[model samples]
Target: MIQITRTIAIDEGELDESFVRSAGPGGQNVNKLSTAVQLRFDVRNSPSLPEGVRSRLERLAGRRLTRDGVIVILAQRFRTQERNREDARERLIALIREAAVPQAPRVVTRTPFSEKRKRRDEKARRSKTKSLRTGPIHHD
Candidate 1:
């Protein structure tokens, strides 16, 4: 089972992993070893996630979520397939955890009266400075 948070946990079966050759470092062994991990999870079909959480996950996933509603994550940072797989799984868990939390609604705030007055005073000062730069009009 993969635990996203205290409230959310997904079955291990929900995660699918694929291993491919890693591109960076590792000398000749890099060509022969399939150390990279590709992890896939179907957000739409998962029975564990609430509809609200699933929707949020889709939005939070960005490019990771495919058109078919599958979330794919690739991990190639580690040199061994097991480490890469673990890394991918951990990333998926982190994503799910982030999505599962409800965001607090932002409270709209009004500018303080003092702040408004200060801004107005600043503008007035600027206007006065600019006006003083002009030569007095000759009334002849």
Candidate 2:
């Protein structure tokens, strides 16, 4: 079981991993060995996650989430399958942990009166300066 938080624990069976060949840094070994790990988790059907976390995870997963509600994580940073697997699992955990945290409510704030006045004054000053740059108005 993967413990995401004090309240959330996902079963090991929830995760599915597949190995594939990785590109970059491994040289000849990269061509021969399947070092990349593709980890998949079904967000829609997971019994472990809270509904809020599930929604947040779906948003966070973005393009990684399939139409069927599976999150696909590809890990190829390491040159060994074990390392890639670990990396994938760690990434999943991190993502889930992030989703578990509640977002802080945004406070609606108005512009300060002094700041607004200062901006207006600056704009007025700029307009006056630009107006002065023009030649004196002439009446026909």
Candidate 3:
């Protein structure tokens, strides 16, 4: 099981891994070896995630989330399959951990009276400064 948090643990079976040839530094070996790791996790159907977390994960997955609600993460930074696999898993874990955290509700606040007054005062001061720059005003 992959422990995402103190309360969330996902089974290893939930993850599907596929290897494909990665286009990066590896000399001639890059052409022959499938070092890239593609990790898939079905967030919508997974029993491991709570409803809130599942929704958040789906949002966080962005373009990586497929039409079927599978999150596909590609890890090709490393040249070896083992390293790439680990990278993919670590990324998944991080993503899950991020989703697991509950977002705090934004507290709506009104602008302080003092602040509004201060802004108005500044605007008036600027207007005065500009007014003084002009020639003596007549009965125009």
The model with the greatest TM-score is 3
**What Cα-based lDDT does every candidate model obtain?**
0.91, 0.94, 0.94
The all-Cα superposition gives candidate 1 an RMSD in Å to the true structure of 1.7
Cα RMSD for candidates in order? 1.7, 1.5, 1.7
Positional deviation of residue 50's Cα in model 2 after best superposition, in angstroms = 0.4
Against the true structure, candidate 1 has what lDDT?
Answer: 0.91
The parts of candidate 2 lying over 4 Å away from their true place are none
Model 2 lDDT per residue over 1-140, tens place: 88889999999999999998898469899989999999999999999999999999999999999999999999999888898999999999999999999999999999999999999999999999999999988999
Better of 1 and 3 by lDDT: 3
TM-score of 1: 0.90
Enumerate residue pairs that collide in model 3.
none
What's the residue-level lDDT of 52 in candidate 1?
A: 86
Clashing pairs in 2: none
